[model samples]
Target: MRPLIGVTTYREPARWSVWDQGAALVPESYVEAVERAGATAVLLPPQADAGRLVGVLDGLLLAGGADLDPARYGADPHPRTGAPQGARDTWEFDLLAAALGAGVPVLGVCRGMQLLNVALGGDLVQHLPDGSHQDPPARFVKTEVRTVGGSRIAAILGEDTQVNCYHHQAVARLGDGLRATARSADGVVEAVETDGPGFVVGVQWHPETDLSDLRLFEALVSAGKKG
Candidate 1:
């Protein structure tokens, strides 16, 4: 059976056609990446009980979205920090905790990466020193990141690789049991992973944005199959 990968979605006000409403949605690229990686994609909306689904899922993919509440890591929000998506923050925190506890293969993208770090007891920089990561807004900028040897990221992306970046926040202090696996030229944390058995990786870049390379998604699918 193809592994079932549960992907998180954003809860936001959306407009389409003649109607406007709050929707639970995620970029189609994420779903496509997972499907192309040979797994079943399941979209998970924010909910109080999202964590319980980990028992049935082979893997968890936390898609990028709004900024997390800084209070999650015990800090006040910066002036430039986007308003907190409290519900999403609470739901993802629970879901991630459950996934970790269940030893499920997990991958976090962009804001998802930040969420993972905060959930694991780390804080964020709130804003980057430079605006290149998201200069024009709503667009991805290519940045080269150096990967640590022997890390899961290096295994998939080699020693140095160009990544699509679109975030203004980054990991400050690392979470417990996690190590920085990739960094940018400016020394920003680009990727992190747990040393435990099950696959648990997070990348600040949006791998799904560039389908030309699906190694990250493929790795998650392969791990899901074994899981």
Candidate 2:
């Protein structure tokens, strides 16, 4: 059976010609990436019940979105972090927690990666500016990252590969059951994953935007199949 992959969506207010309603939405690229990987993409509505998440899909992918509320990590909001979306934060956070508890495979890209870390008690830098910033700028430019052998991330990209990143906040401290598997110049956590099997990998980059070398999605799809 094609792996049933649950892709999370961002919640936003919508308007019709003469009416308005709240809606959950995701980008077409995300859905396309999943389908291209030979998996059936299921757009999981926001604020979904956590207990019900595991049964609907073999794996989950937390797609990118707005910055997380710094409060979730016990920090004063940074000036560059933008406004908080409390409802969205609560929804994704709860879903991530339940997904991990259920042992559902996961891949968190950019903001998604941060969410995974926060859910597991990790913290994030409220905002990142270069020079004095700890990690490399999320908008990495043709840079290579190093990965440890036998590491989950290493197994996906073969050796280290150049990736496209475009986020400011990044993993400051890792979450429980996850380890930093890859890093770049200036010491940014590039990738992370669970210690064991079932493929739970998160990258501080956007692999879907890098379709030229799509090993990332293929690996997720293959793992989802196994799950």
Candidate 3:
């Protein structure tokens, strides 16, 4: 049987046809990527009982979304910071704790990576100095990042790779037990991972949007099998 993977989602006003109302949704590309990687993908909306749901999942994917509340890391919001999604923040934190405790395979993308950092006692830069990560609004741009030798990212993507990026915030202070695995030319952290038996990796890029490469998703699914 294919491993079951749950991808986090956004809860906000959305429109389709004549209906405009609150919806729990994620990008179709995320689902497509998980499917292509040979896992069963499920959307995880913010819920109080999300931690309990992790019991049935072989893997948990923290999908990219809105900015996290700066309060999470004991910092005031930057002028460029967007409003926080309180429900999603609380839910994902609980869900992440449960997943990590259960030794489930986990992957984080873009905003997801930021959340992972903040959850583990780290912080974010709020906004990049040059803002080159996102060239245009609502579109991904190509950015080159080099992975540290012997890191999991390097093992999968080799020493360097071009990734699709659309994030303004980057990892500022690394979280507890996590180590930087990849970085860009500007010295911004691009990827992070923990030293443990579980598969926990986070990347500051939208790998799902870049269908040309499925190594990250594939790696998560492969780890899910062992999980």
Candidate 4:
């Protein structure tokens, strides 16, 4: 059977209408990437029943969205935390904790990475100012990251990677049990993984933004298939 990778969803609504009207919802392109990778994509909504999710999924993916609740990692919210979706933030965080506890293969992208870090007892840098990042923050520019060769990530991609980054928050103090597997020239934590097994990895870049970035998804699918 194909691996069922559960992709977490965002909880942003266009407007506060009647409760029965429902909110406009959309899944990100990463969902399609999972499909193209030969894995079944399942949208794990913020309101999903966790008791029902564990047995149904072989892997978990935490996608990018808005800022995380600083309270999650024991810090005050940054000025940019903006209109925080406390409910969605809380749900995904709990979902991630459950995934880790269940030893599910997980790939955290962008804010997903940040969430994974927090869930593992790590902290975030709230904001990245230019000239401060060991390299330029680059904001939305395409950039290169140096992976620790022979690490799981480098072994999977098999070369240096060029990715598009659109995040301001980053892994500040890494969460317990996670290790930095890749980094940008300016010292930004670009990639991370668990110290043990289960193929848990997180990248600060947006692989879903480009269809050609299939190698990562393929690797995850291949790992999930092994389970």
Candidate 5:
């Protein structure tokens, strides 16, 4: 059987045709990336049963979304910080905790990366100065990230790679048991990985948006197969 990869999604107000309502949504790019990497994609809506959900999945993929509420990391909101989606934040955090406890292979993208940092007791920079990590009007800015030697990111994307980024916040402190594995030219944390096995990794950029490499998702699937 193809490894089942559960991807966290956004629960937000959306519009479809004439109908406007709240829904669980994730960009199709994520699903395509997972499928391209030879895994079955499953969308996981925000809920309270993350522990239960993680038990059956072979891997977890935390898709990008809104900024986390700063309170999660013991800081007040920054004026430029995007509004938080409390339900999504709570659900994804629970999922990450459960997945980590279960030793599942996990990948976090963009906001998902920030969430991982905060969940592990690390704080964020809130808003990057002078739009270093993002361009104005929420556009994805292309930037190059240098990976650490012998790190997982380096192993996958080589030493230097161009990525698509669209965030104003970044990991400001190293999370417990995690280390920075990549950085942009401006010195923002671009990627992080846990010290042990099972492919626990996070990237500040959107690999799905890049579409040039499926190695990251492929690594997640390979790890999922080992379980």
Candidate 6:
């Protein structure tokens, strides 16, 4: 059976066609990327019992979304920081903790990466000036990231690679048991990984937006299969 990968999603007020209501949604790119990586993609919306699902899932994906509540890391919000989705923040945090506890493979993107850092007793930069990590609103900026020697990111994406970036906040201080594996030209932490047995990796880029390379997802699925 294909490994089941549970992806966290955004619960927000959405508008489509003539209908406008609160919904739990994630970009199709994330689902497609997971499916293309040879795994079964499952959307995990915010819930009181999200942690219970971790045991049955082969892997957990913390999909990119809104900025985390600064309170999570014991810091005041930056002036330029986006509004926080408190419920989603709490839900994803629980899911991440549960997945790690279960020793399941986990892949975190953009905001997901930041949350992982915060969850692991780290902090964030909060707000980056224009042209630092991101270009403009709704635009993806391309940048090259150099991977650490013998790191999981280096294994999948190689020592040097170009990636799609779209975030202002970044990992300021790495979490416990996590090591920085990749960095951009501006010195922002681009990727992090744990030395533990489980496959726990986080990247500041949006791999789902670039389907040309599915190695990252494939690696996650492969790790899930092993779990």
TM-score of each: 0.97, 0.88, 0.98, 0.88, 0.97, 0.98
Q: Tens digit of lDDT per residue, candidate 1, span 1-111?
A: 899999999888899999899998999999999999999999999876765798899999999988888888889989988898888888888899999988899999999
Regions more than 4 Å wrong, model 3: none
Predict model 5's lDDT versus the native: 0.91
Once superposed on the true structure, which residue ranges of model 5 sit more than 4 Å away at CA?
A: none
- The residue-by-residue lDDT of candidate 3 on 45-162, one tens digit each, is 9987766799999999999989999999999999989998999999999999999888888899988889889999999999875558987567777889999998888998999999
Per-model CA lDDT versus the true structure: 0.91, 0.81, 0.91, 0.81, 0.91, 0.92
Task: List, residue by residue over 1-227, the lDDT tens digit for candidate 2.
Answer: 78988888887888869869877888778888888888989988765576687677778889987999888889998888879888778877877777777777788988999998998889998766753322444444555778878897897786677777777778998998889999877688889888876677888888888656667788878877776
Estimate, for each residue in 1-227, the C-alpha lDDT of model 4 and write its tens digit: 88999888765545544454445254558878998999998887678567468567888888887788888889988786656678788888878878777777889988899988998889999888853432443346577889987688888765678788877788999999899888877799999998766788999988888887698888788878877
Clashing pairs in 5: none
Which residue ranges in model 2 land beyond 4 Å of their true spot?
Answer: 13-22, 130-142
Ten consecutive residues with minimal summed lDDT in candidate 2? 131-140
Indicate the residue-level lDDT of 207 in model 1: 96
C-alpha lDDT (0 to 100) for residue 145 of candidate 5? 94
TM-score of 6: 0.98
Error of 6 at 57 (Å): 0.3
On a 0 to 1 TM-score scale, where does candidate 3 land against the true structure? 0.98
Backbone clashes counted, model 6: 0
